[model samples]
Target: MASLNILMAQINTLVGDFEGNTDKVVACVQRAVQSHPSPVVVFPELTLSGYPPEDLLLRPSIELRVAQSLARLCAELPAEAWAIVGYPRTRDDGLYNVAGVIHGGEIVAEYSKQSLPNYQVFDEKRYFKPGSLPCVIDIEGVQVGLSVCEDIWEPGPTLATARAGAQLLINLNSSPYHRGKRGERWQLVAARATEAGIPIVYVNQVGGQDELVFDGGSFAVTAGGDIAAAAPNFEEGDFWLQYDSDHAQAPFSGLQVYPPLEEIEAVWRALVLGVRDYVNKNRFQGVVLGLSGGVDSALTLAVAVDALGPERVEAVMMPFRYTSQMSVEDAAEQSDILGVSHKVISIEPIYEAFMASLEEEFAGTEVDTTEENLQARCRGVLLMSISNKKGYLVLTTGNKSEMAVGYSTLYGDMAGGFDVLKDVPKTLVFDLCRYRNTLGPCIPQRVIDRPPSAELAPDQKDEDSLPPYEVLDQILEMYIERDMSAEAIIATGMDRQQVQKVLRLVDINEYKRRQAPIGVRITKRGFGRDRRYPITSGWRIGD
Candidate 1:
């Protein structure tokens, strides 16, 4: 009848907010103790400092802050419970990402993360000195092993811990979200559990941090690679699982694993969570995005309202000569439906004024993208003004497709503090718009049905300048995300001309993307921190 209660502390943490994050830890431990006796509570990696603390780890105060917080936890926590939480441990050699076990108001055991992920949005190697040993401690007559985020990804630490006489294993994580990542985690963890023959419990952080969003799809798996329990994705809460020695074959019992989020649904939640945390964490009063009648803006507006609510979101429609009457109507309609504050400020006068002022400088240049860019700049100015005055964040609506090919104008449409769809491609933007419609009446149906245009030029269709989004997005995914070369992509049956054009655009547009705002990253490689390319490069567009 020997059994243990495990509480998964899937909580959101603000990076560098030691006091606040510690408060959450203390509260969670207290809450778990009240309900379950001698509960084994596990928190995500870097629980006190938050994940990807980035350069904040370099500051001298990091050691002080972590020590203070750890001391507070030891003093405040109940003596009976065993709480395993992640924090950066400083040693004479260097700093290490360690999961420390707190029992009876003191850290009884510690295990530093062995695998420091350095690629693609992670730079842990720059900060942490990897640990070589596995830590297994006795908890309530049961032996448990400990590891941090990246340790579970590799076989070394898991196998090493299992060999150390551990009957159970606990891994902490601050794993970020990308489409299809959850499935990858499930498969990988199941393999580890089956190989080690030790039932494992995984806990992950939930919430957004800058371009990164932790989905928190924590779970437990049996030694035979079967799922025993799972926490929901893109949420923050404490979920419990029971481990009984008597039922070794199916020891986990308190919670059952449910179906994970579908890919599209998970992406939508990632966007919402990313936007919400970016705004709230930065302490912005609210968010204001340009609600052009275009699909991109329409989708961005819907996400904003859903993330921050109608009261905290404001939509401004700035129209130019090319801006259609239908565009105006649809923007107003959606805004009305969403109950967000909507304002229409015609940019015609602003455009005219800019043109008039630049008349002398633009002596004999034939009209081109410059004029179209001026229109976008006009709207950018209006939005930035509102943002500045009202203390609201200006959310740009440029999609990844436009961002990939430099279709946006710098200091024009790209002028903003944040871009919600910065990582979402145009094709997916429409899908999300349609998806939002399915949830409720937020985006207008016509907005989803209509052809996407910048409305910068009369009779402008995005396809007129660039290829159709369906083709463009596919190529972009191959080139940017998959890192496929133009020839490789063309050999895969894509049109050579379109592939060349897209690759060329993507390569040359690094300057523009460098200046673009940070947004949610839902793909394996987003334009932000996920994909890093130099603005200045002599590299050609070939393999």
Candidate 2:
């Protein structure tokens, strides 16, 4: 039996760092050659320019840099093995997302991606022209097919390669992580393999970009739609598989399959990776957040410490007139337990100064939510000032439910460099808190048990203005994610008036969400890129 060794190099790449990305590829290739003789190395899509370079692809200098990087790879790549890598290619027609095969220190074959995903966080159509044909290459007398990330999702590319007499398929990817996305990928790849009647090797990139985190759960499936091997998610490494050609009927064997992560663990790891990469890549000294001993802030603090450690995290408790004694005590306790730098700052003086300055403008009007919002703005100003002075990124703790109903005050509680829970719902917030406690008691028991509140007004609670989170989250998931109308939501045994009110809040809050900081996206439709609605639209639910 002739055995073929294949290496899947799942790497973390920085956007537009051509030299650095190339260096990583060269180093991996050298290591692969030293460890395994005559192996075919596969890397993720656009490994050179990183995934979704956004408008960086439009720059002219990017083309030159890519060319230079490819040249360097050709010179430095080990000649003992074959390598498959992804990058952007410039042709007379237009630019394309391409995968190239390298052997004997030269480019051997190239495959342009046929499917261009333009929805959600992807804008590939804005940059590249799609290819119409499939690419098949011959490696040591074995026929192999090539596909990019989106190519296998559709039917044509993989089928075309199969019809072209390929024995195996290698798909390179930069697919991002969302809840249950790993299972979806496996099912899709399994179907593709079965339809093509050939085994597949799927390699994906792993790391965090601005708002996207690629969980490298790379794997392979046999032609019979059985998973042959699987790599761990949220990790970076080289996963190996051996294909025995001598057993022509059953070439895939001796697979190493890693277990899948549960929903809570997967979401937690994604948040940690996203926060860590954003801070490290942007070169922030550390992170700081206003802790109110609430579930939201507590979860944000825990995520920050886990991402960068306690030494890099600072917790500030800003107390106003409405602040509860329990909140103060709990915040201090959590800080002590986590060993983070904890400080207590009173916002009363700042609020007083602001009210005095606005007395003349507010002479005829009684106090309303304006005063409540002022308290939040005072804390926002303090946090931002600290961030500016100490090079710390302020982590805002607003959840999806508040952001949906405009419960968050823009430039007040919404002010920060990054939001750790922007896409997380309120119910999920409680669940994640409980999950964190299972690891250890990082969050206070009282905080988790107590009712949620903003503490900006006297005896304020979240439910006083909005519906219960359990009800609110359901309506939101239906309307925002599933695109159910207000009438449709009401049909599910919800009150018509309540449904209308929730929908209206979401519609009016578009402007606020437009200015909100980018956060980790854990769902199919996040506010930033996935769900884009016009702020000034006249379209209403029943219209």
Candidate 3:
């Protein structure tokens, strides 16, 4: 019986860092060749320029950089290994997202990606011209076919490749992580395998890039639409699979299929990876966040500690006249529990000075939200000053619900380099806080139990200003994420008045969300690239 050895080079690459990415590919191929005989090594899509190199693909120098990297891979990689790599290829016709096979230190076969995704965080149609043909090659007497990430999502490319006379198919991917994406990939790929009548291998990249995070849950499927093998999610490493020409039970061996991460668990890991990469890639020394003894900030603190250790995390509690003693103590307790640097700063003196400066300006005016916003601005100034002096990235703690309704003050709680829960809704915020506590005593129980408040005014709670979170989050999800109209949401048995109020708030707050910092995207649609709305538009609320 003859068999083929395959290695999945699951890796994380920096965008536009051609030298670094090529070095990783060469090293991966070298390590694979040392263990297996003529092993087939597969890497993720856009491995050379990194996934979604975005506007970097527009630079004229980008063409030269990709060519040089490809040349270097052929020169430095071992001749015995057969490596499949992905990069952008510039031809006279146009640019293409291509997968190339390198064997015996030469380019043997090339496959251009056929399907270019253009919706919801992807704009590939702007760059690459789609390919219409199939690519097949003979490897060690075994016929093999090739496809890129979006190709396997549909039936046409997979069927076309198999019909081109292939016994096996391999896919290169740079698929980003959203909630429940792992199961979706498994079911979709399995169907593709059944349609093609050939075993399929899927390899994806792992790590974070700005607002996006790839989970790297690579897997394989048999011709009968069964998942034969799977690598773990949220990990970057190499795994092996074998294909046997003659076998009694199954054609593939070394099966290690594991179930997907539970929904909340997947969200937590994605948040941690997103934060770590954003801070380290941008070269920030560490992170500093205001500890309000609220659920949102408490959850953000725990994630920051888990990502970069406690030594690199710092917590500052800014107390105002309305801040309760209980909030002060809870913030201190959680900081001590996590073993992070904790400090106490009083914004009273600063707020007093500001009020005194504006005393004459407010001579005839009655008290309103201006005083509340002034309190938040005082704390924002303190945190930004600390960031400037200590070289730390300030992490804001605003949740999606607050951002949706414009309940947050500008340049106050919203002023920071990054917002950890920008895409996380308020109801989800409480759920995540409880989830983190299951691992250990990270967040204080009292913090989770208390009614949420901004402490901007005396005896004020979040519900006092906005609808209950249970009602607010649902309406926001319908309008912002699913694009449902106010009437549609009301038809679902929700309060019509509440739905209209929430939708109006969301429409008016586009300007604030536009200026907000980017954060992790764990849902189907996030505030950053996933959802775009005009800050100034005459569009009204309707069907």
Clashes of each: 0, 0, 0
Q: Which pairs clash (backbone N, Cα, C closer than 3 Å) in model 1?
A: none
Native-to-model Cα distance after best TM-score fit, residue 417 in candidate 1, in Å = 1.0
Please report, in order, the local distance difference test score of every candidate based on alpha carbons.
0.92, 0.92, 0.91
lDDT tens string, model 3, 1-543? Answer: 666788888899999889999999999999998999999999999999998899899998989999999999889999988999999999999999999999998999999999999999999999999999999998877888999999998899999999999888999999999988998999999889888788898999999999999999899888888888899999999989998756523667785987899999999999999999999988899999999988899999999999999999999999988999999999999999999999999999999999999999999999899999998888899999989999999999999999888988899999999999998999999889889999998999889989999988999999997999998998889998899988889999999888878888888888999988889999999997999889889996632
What would you estimate as the lDDT of candidate 1?
0.92
Q: Residue 102 of model 2: what lDDT?
A: 90
Q: Model 2 segments beyond 4 Å from truth?
A: 248-250
Candidate 2 deviates by what RMSD?
1.1
Tens-digit per-residue lDDT, 331-449, candidate 1: 99999999999998898888889999999999888999999988888888898999999999999999899999999999999999989999899889888888888898888788888
Model 2 lDDT, residue 203, Cα? 96
TM-scores, in order shown? 0.99, 0.98, 0.98
Assess the local accuracy of residue 466 in candidate 2 as a C-alpha lDDT between 0 and 100: 93
Q: How close is candidate 1 to the true structure, as a TM-score?
A: 0.99
Candidate 1's C-alpha runs over 4 A off are: none
